[model samples]
Target: MTFQSVFRWFGRRGQSTVHQVDQDGQKEFTFRAVALGLIIGCLLCFTNLYFGLQTGWISMMSLQSALIGYLMSKFLPTPITAQENIVLQTTAVATGTMPLAAGFVGILPALGLLEEDRDGTPPVHLSWIASVGWSCAVAFFGVFLSPPIRKQVIIEEQLAFPSGTATAQLISVLHELPPPDTTLRQRRGYTELDTEETLNDELSPVEPTELERLHEAAKPEPEGWSSLTWSFLASGIMTLGAYFFPVIFSVPLFGNYLAKQWLWTFTPSLSYIGQGIIMGFPTTLSMNLGMLVGWGILSPISKHAGWAPGPVGDMTSGARGWILWTSLAIMCSDSLVSLGPVISEIVYKKLLRRSISLEDEEDKEDKEVEPDDRLVPMKWVIWGLSGSVVFGTILVWMVFGNEGIKPWATLVGFVMGGLLSVLGVRALGETDLNPVSGLGKISQLLFAWIQPGNVVANIIAGGVAEAGAQQAGDLMQDLKTGHLIRASPRAQFYGQLIGSFLSIIVTTTAYTLYNRAYQIPGPSFPAPTAYVWLGLARLLRDGDLPEKSNVFMLAFGLFFGLVSAIKTYASQRQRWYAKWIPSGVAFAIGFLNTPSFSIARLIGGVVEYIYYRQVGKENGGIRLIIIASGFVLGEGVVSVISLILRTFGVGVASCWGCAHGMCGGCPS
Candidate 1:
């Protein structure tokens, strides 16, 4: 059958003998696929952390994982199945954390940076109590917001989850059991190719493919309905209890609750931990600066000329307003620009294209299938909204009611946060569609609105804001994965909640140790580049533009936005771009990084291109790239684990310690 025919099979739910139509006949769940995904996931995560520690960009993992995953697919004993392949790859991609809220707070303290107590505690000596508090808060807020965000982005828009897409390919490759004809290679420039020899026999559920089955089974059912309830319940409990808790302990609790309150108020003041180590100053600066430039200058210019920058609001609220306007602009640009191709493709294939005449053999399946063409139902939206309100209430009470914010502000924040996610996905290319940053900006604006020294309002707003933005991108990606693979949105949301909750315990313990013992000095001190940028924006909003220097910042912001658009487009069109180069390069290069580092990345890219070009060669060029990429990723994550452990004053005799001893140097 032709490629178009195969896709038609995927879009349908239960036509084949199997409960689900494998996107390709080759696609199915299996142990091999899960193992492969797990191994790759670990490698990607480790490598990302290593590089994050070294170069400071989250997308680095995406580039390297794509290249390696592509290579690994080449050497499978059976022909690699495309669906499983995408799943695995996307999993690896999402596994790479960015500048999320808790990540920054936890990571910085672990590295012996950031004065934890706000008094005189050494930067390395952060409180475990505080770490736990923050982690729990992040998990609480992050998990709840995921489903609503998922609903708004993936369900509402039907946008492709870029990260999820990559992951689906990865998983699909692993699960496809009745291998295709491996010996064949494609002829050049052919629009279609012959299918590999049919499976010698009909395949059955086998033990080898159990992992994929388990993963599928593990997915949230009822479309995240239960998780939404849990979020609501959790928010209610936390909000009322905030008044009784200590300020430090309550900070995370309230902050997390408010994560969904207002999109702009969700970002926090101290959200530098994750990005600080993962991204260079230039990229981070530019992203933040874009918001400022758009808000502070672009919005005003438009307003002066009798035009509003999108539909968000007025842009004259200083730098804060500028950020809001820019955010709206970017979001609008991304959504409007991307929807056409995506919709056309879906409409053509799912509706018109599949109806083309088919042979009797293909018709056999169609004859047995249900004719319903409906997408996921609307019950999910109700579930998402109900959950958001519940969670937002809890967050508000915890932060605003207890710490210092008024109840009214908390309510406003929650509403704003959900709106942010809706707009974020509809506009910005934020696949995760989080509202924390927007909420935080809103809180900041509120501070200006309410006499400027409402520290409680500012603090609570900041916490929620950080969490919202922290989880925004990832949320979008997860939703996208759910959308494409026919995974339940509710299930994906629940899964995220489970992961985030567990992460609290894992990250809290790790972070506590990292803060107390393993402080590195000099070049190793992680820079709070994004924070600096935020501060600068804040200063500008305070009516003190840096005069001539502001021009450079604006230029950088424009450059960053353009590159982000290009990167987004490339990721959608070409699978290889995400696999090897990652979107990180554009951001990282904008900084004054050491020349050698850039050269090394360049060499890595060249090596990847060479491997990709020779996929059909005798030695199997693609396999070489995957194995090498695996090693690189493995080495990177491993090194970070070692260093973090060392920072905790753990014994150096372990394997990790040995690596650190060898590679350890003054931080750059």
Candidate 2:
């Protein structure tokens, strides 16, 4: 679509009838589907908690959950409708993404003790119930804010919501029966009367009978079932084999040996490759560029200039600390600039009472739709928002006030969270990025100014804002998927609510267990994001800016970020310039992670690009996505299992220390 046409489509407020509606009106929000979703959601939440602590990134489980849910329905005595599968996936996404909001999983645990050097100082202890309560309240507050913007963003704005779109496609394909070749139809007990001629005759300007609808629904399984099943098994076995080589057999080459010795970073992770494929070329390329700049150039320059200590125990780890600060500068600036148009539009339309556009009489007719198409009642939305505010206020007071945070400051933070959530959702809608860390930094600066010298208040307020924004952006993406598939908004909302509650409980518990097993910021669990948050909070609280050289680097990063943001914004209008503008956030993320991971991701993106060119984008390239999803699912499941086994001191990797280049035999 042309830019103007696409813009108009997004700006048009109306319900969509893009997909085929279910004729049977079957049970979509059933007890069975929800139970299955909850089970899968909890599993995903646990794994995400573990993985996020390990890698500083959370894996997307929507596609995996959809495939598993669909496979389960197929093997069961009674099959679920496609709508039911969508609901299941939605719930799974809600829970799977919740780890992003949990303080322990993301930031809280890395704070460690307020006074670690003191003889009897206790560790930073956040009560499980308080964590769960605050997270749920903030997440629900985000959910409550989503319905009002659903029409503007999803229907009118037509955001891609990339993951959600992929899940919807998976649901459609898995639920569809094989195309009716005459032979195949006949074998499935279809009569000659069920042919196209008879079908047309039965539907000639008259309502089809129930029997006709039943006949339509009675088809064989999808044509690609064999390919999907075989691919899934093959990928799983491959992942299992790869997992054993480096871990069990002490094979250096299969792990990070090549990277350590030669700097040829190649991660043997199919899951990372899949993620790269999903992230696409622009993001992966930007990340690689960041890695090159941060480690290849900046680190060496800093060491030569006597600004950084020479070659530490872990060079990458030390360099990452500098990169983290640089990234914060870039992310904060880019996020604020990117949010300009969205914030302006919201203010103009809502607060200023200005008409967004002039609607013609014919346009009014086109916009007319049934009330049944609406997802949720306005009354429910109001009540939910009100309840969230009251409960959120109480939770904030009870949780933070006990630690000497002022009630007014807590209230201000809650209000700021709601405002930031609007920006968060808009950013996600526009760019498929949630600037949580940037939002947190912004919140921290704001709260530091409001409540100076109170580190507890600063951290708590910032956490609340970040958590709210992250959850809000995530839920809106889920809502977009629901809108696309014609799922009930009310049903999706309830699923989200249930999923969020379960996720808070499950992830918090998992975090506690994992923390006890392997202390965070130690050798195994780096918790890099948490470290960043803790460092930032301390810096703001103590008014300790970086040294002169580091400040120059930060300024350089800020300038680069501003230029990148401008180019990106300009490229939207001038599509020809798009290839020249890289994603700043992707670059920042690249610096935050190991170089090997980014290299693997880039390779995956290259593979995907070549495959797309060969197959053509319109010629059912979704099959490739399904295969990638299989690889991700296989590796992720195995990784989680490995971690669980290691928790009990069973099946620990023989090369664990060596793989990380900590052993004497390995290169530093």
Candidate 3:
């Protein structure tokens, strides 16, 4: 199938299954499948944990798992069925996502760094058990919530679960039987030469005949694997060299550097650039606009008004505090407004007395008696939810009771998390985006109101809500994939459960090890997401309100957020003018981190745009995406390896901050 056809398949809504029958009946959940799935899932889980903490983004493992599984299946003595592949992908994705529960890892450790002994409160040191328990509780709650969400959103509402649909198509294509006498290469649109002379003549470096050149020109350009490999190697070598060589010899433009006099910072990060390419131009542009407003406009104005705490160039100083407050206000308002349509739809369907349409009624009746072997029983889901609530309640109280959080409050947090999960799932189903930060902010606000001046309570409560909602949305998306491929939902559910358990163990260990090796929110790590959460928690706990000018900025931000949301909503109705509205979250994200990171990402987006214009979307754009993905993965692996070396005291002088002169007294 063409790339365009696959793209179209993602957005189309109809029956879940594209194939009339399962290619391999009831072959899922085999030992080989489970073992391979577990291995792949654990690898990805570790990688995601490492990457997400370094950057604010986690790589989705569905496509990776599917591709890897397909290739691995070739070596098995018995044929690897599509159903088994579905189970494998589901397991890998679930495990990979579980580490996101530690999204709070960055924040929590940063809180430790920010703590002072003179304040009389103990330093924030979450035990390994507490970390594991909390992560598992939140993630499992999401898993339990997935089944009902799948039925409502995927089955009844027929929402476009884009990633899930694409994954399903990929599995179908992989498992499809080729026509007789057709080789795999032939099936994929490559012709086999009858002899070595034909192959060598076509590929000869010496002057080729016109026919040979034309034949070579007609052949598809070597892409996908070849492009990905070269890009991965190039990015990896560059990043590794920059990290190590900068100490021995400095290259002015190769490493992260700052020019405080000119109020400019440069961070040459392959990972950030890759993220920019993936996120596209609109998001990158929105982020740059935010940087302009916060650092360019607001910082100077605050400095002039004597509201700034330090020089405008110092991001760590209080010059950017107003920007944080204003951005939070904007993000909160935008998140709520974005939910209006989904809320309205739910209310109309549940409360209105309108009779069901005849066709819909018939469809519902057919759905009730459909002969589907893959359906996960509703009772299992209920039981799973009940067990999770019971265990989660006990764990939360056990882990957090010493921190002054009441058991009742933890329960309230869980309830709020479940409700928020419903919203998160709905949003993801329709738009393929989960408002995780928004949901977390809502929880933070609610808990802040309930128990003022309690930072521990606020963070923990908010973490539960955010983690649960995110996991729920992620799992429901996986279920959508299973549904489309006719994979047994019960088996998929089991796979998710096992994968989640493994994730909790693996991620918790990784977090503890990494934190022990490096200080978060410090010069080396610079956990940006943690900084935002820490800032908000401190503001709430210290009873500090936004300053007068900040309050004004907050109001303006809210107005801008609302306007953006309205434009986005209108754009969904095909309004041309409304389509130009930028994403509020992207803008807010720019303020959450240093300007250099946003600038690097914008550079990536610009390159992508130029590529699109020059080479068109079909041919070169797809190759660029593969190359970008390789760059991200390669950089992530090297970063993790460097961290591990640091943990073992190998080349300890060559830390992340050494290049930027943040590591004082390190060997020069």
Candidate 4:
């Protein structure tokens, strides 16, 4: 099929059997496929735990899983079909992200961190089994929530879920028909007589037979020397180098003094730049604006004014802690207010009973013919939502009965979760950014009022929204991948359901093992994301917060957040400068982290812009995306390896220089 035809398949839900059409009679939802996915997913689960605790973000390596699955499938009785491959990737992505959705590195660990922070406060630790139950209960509903979201976002509006789209395209390329006789590569430069072993040794490391040369030349690009592969390797090498020589790429935006005081350094993170390339320029720009405001503008002011009185970057008593509340306020206000348009439209449709038709009769017919078997049944949604809510409520009441989380409050959190899932899915679709952190903070803010002064209640409430948003975002993105590849939505749904259950055990086990080995929320793990959540939780409840200007900061943030969201909606409606409007979620993320992260992302955006401009927008864009995905995968996989190495005591050296004070002393 032509390239356009391949992408056109993204909108072709009516056919619904693209798997059969494309995969040479290969079946989907195969036993081996799922088994492979589970195996890989179980193994891949560790990477995210490493990433989340260190970077406070998770990068889904669906492409890496796809590539790895392809390589591994060769040893099986029969090579897995493309549909099966999608299942493998789906399962792996699902399993890998479970830590994120379940809050293993965030809310759960924050509980431990908070306990440690408080003197004489009894520690509240959930049994591992209870952790599994709560995590699964909170996350499984999103799997059920995926089908409708898929129909709306992936099929109807067709927002570019970048990671998903790239995954689909990669799977398509892998399963595409073999090259025609005397393929394009042969026409590019090579000939039957040419043997280049002497000239460029890497191109032909060993002398190959005529058939081998023909086969190599028939492929579009040699597998051994793919530009994307090299890009992946280069990124990984850079990451390793940075790990060893840490301070080199941590470039100070201001002088070393300010860089030490305010973390305004360009972090040595190619992973984030790859994230920026995927996120595109607009959201990254908003993140930079946030970094400037939170770190550049407010960080210094807060410290100098004594609004925050602890050491720098202290979540409990430092500027970082103080700024977190304002950040939460802005994100909560912005996200909640941003929902006005969506809510209004829903209400308008309900009240007026207006069914403004699809783009045309073709879409109308597509919708009408969209098979029930292909869609996630509403029964599943009802059952999943109800089942998960009941399970979660029971768990909450049983565990947190004394913590002031009544069953009714638990139900409210679930309801709030459902509402925030809409916002989360929207963000994921538009920017490939899941605002689950913001969603969690919003939950905390609401519950701070509902069950005042109850920190545990606030944390659990936030988890409800966090898990829901994370799963909602994850499943929708995974479904988007299946949608493009003509894999069965029903099959993908089953895969996610299975993965969710597995994640409950697999990811929980991984974290429990890691936490036992090395205490989390320590200097090494930090659990920065959880720190932010905990900081918000404490700020909302602590009496000392009133003594500082943090509340005033939060109030100011709320005001500005409302204005920003209002201006954003008004501008979009009035055909004003909507694109220029800074994203509240992105800004909040900036406040949550330091400048190094956002600056790295901004650089990635700039790099992507240059590529889009220099290389034409069509084929080059796709190529860049595929390569950029490699960049992300490379660094992430390397980081995971580095963590494992550290566990083994080989890669223990840290903080090569003392200029920025990330390391108390220079290791070198």
Candidate 3 weakest ten by summed lDDT: 196-205
| Model 3 residue 438 CA deviation in Å | 1.3
For model 3 the TM-score comes to: 0.81
RMSD of 2: 11.9
lDDT of each: 0.38, 0.60, 0.63, 0.66
Candidate 1, 503: how far from true, in Å?
Answer: 1.3
The TM-score that candidate 1 achieves is 0.50
Clashes of each: 94, 2, 0, 0
Runs in model 4 deviating more than 4 A are: 1-26, 31-47, 59-82, 115-121, 125-130, 148-229, 235-256, 354-386, 395-408, 422-435, 480-486, 513-519, 522-524, 542-577, 648-656, 664-668
Model 1 alpha-carbon miss at residue 56, Å: 4.0
Task: Write candidate 1's Cα lDDT for 1-668 as tens digits.
Answer: 76434333333321232222242344433333333444555544444433444334444243234334444444444433444443444444434452244544323423343233431233333365555554454444444555555544444333433334444433333343232211212211111111110000001112224435433432332322233234334433432222122121112222332211211211111112222212222233433443334433554464454443343232233222333323333332333333333344445545764454555234334221111221223464466445655555564465224534565565555555554444444432322223333344554555556535343344444555445545655556545544544544433343344445544554445434433443322223232223322332344245454223345345544554565456445544443333222222233222322221333334343444444355421233223323334334434434444555556554422232111111123110
Query: Which is better, 1 or 3, measured by TM-score?
Result: 3
TM-score, candidate number 4 = 0.76
lDDT of 3 by residue, 379-463 (tens): 8778888888778778877876756467777778888999988887876654456778778888888888897777777777887
Candidate 4: C-alpha lDDT: 0.66
Candidate 4 lDDT trough over 10 residues, lowest sum: 196-205
TM-score of every model versus the real structure: 0.50, 0.79, 0.81, 0.76
Ordered from best to worst lDDT, the candidate numbers read 4, 3, 2, 1
Compose the digit string of candidate 4's lDDT tens values, residues 575-668. Answer: 3345456667677777877677778888877887677677634324434554665677677567655556556665435564545665411341
Spell out the clash pairs found in candidate 4.
none
